[model samples]
Target: MVATTLRSIKSLVPLLDRVLVQRVKAEAKTASGLFLPESSVKELNEARVLAVGPGGLDKDGKRLPMGVSQGDRVLIPQYGGAPVKVGEEEFTLFRDSEILAKINE
Candidate 1:
């Protein structure tokens, strides 16, 4: 038999009813090929779901299903998400109930 190595890795796992997401970056250039200045570029309230927590518990101790899942695109509020950073990338965590809406496209 071949030797198998088991390693413990650290990763971000959101708690109950929480969802991890990365903001969708805004375009730096306009349709007419003009580059917008940093001050003029506005941050969007949109993000992509990276991970989701196992749903919250109900009054009877039953687990409720999460509305969003990994790889989903959603709308977030202008404020109130907890910021997180992994390596050189930045992410945010929001409660499932706080996610504004899912983007169909």
Candidate 2:
């Protein structure tokens, strides 16, 4: 089902919204408890924003405000985001509110 839905790497984030996130890498195993893969073990909550959607609606039927821009590194919830595939890349499409923080460095 998801295999056919995903199309491209580019997202359609709007002015007041953002897309959900899915870590690119999977989990890892080692002697020291469990290790997270490099791709998944991003710097804090920072992640390479894969795809984005249009902004959300506002009270007056207007658009709300957005924070980060596409391609920007951001921080999202640790347990949310639905898994999906875009082109050859896998991603998660979670709401911006679920995001914990955004990284500038």
Candidate 3:
């Protein structure tokens, strides 16, 4: 059976066409060929730009500029965010200001 998904309402603070995201994968295995379980892995300090919201207001009461685009992976704090669940995956949302840096590779 297929599962249905829910989309979030337009953000109140305005994403300016940007959505902050935290990945669900907590642990990665080492090169020893041994697999590490979720409980054994250390959480990484990273995130990604998941979705883009509506455009921001322009100087004349219209939308302004957007700081990020889709598929852009970024880094964020370990704490300070709201929990969200999309289908079986869980993620967090942070304001653009909360983003520390962007990852190109």
TM-score of each: 0.83, 0.61, 0.66
Which stretches of candidate 3 lie above 4 Å from their native place? 1-18, 24-27, 55-60
Give Cα distance to truth, residue 68, candidate 1, Å: 0.6
Task: Judge candidate 1 at residue 64 and give its lDDT.
Answer: 93
Runs with alpha carbons beyond 4 Å of true place in candidate 1 = 1-10
Please give the range of 10 consecutive residues that has the lowest summed lDDT in model 1. 1-10
Q: What is the lDDT of residue 77 in candidate 2?
A: 67
Q: Please, what are the lDDT tens digits per residue for candidate 1 over residues 1-105?
A: 112132311266789999989999999999999999998888999999989999999999888999999999999999988887655566788999999999998
Residue 89 displacement in candidate 3 (angstroms): 0.6
* lDDT by residue for model 3 (23-100), tens: 646546778867887788977777766765666566787865556666678777777866666566666666666667
**Comparing 1 and 3 on TM-score, the stronger one:** 1
Quickly count the clashes in candidate 3: 8
Q: After best superposition, candidate 2 residue 52: deviation in angstroms?
A: 2.7
Error of 1 at 30 (Å): 2.3
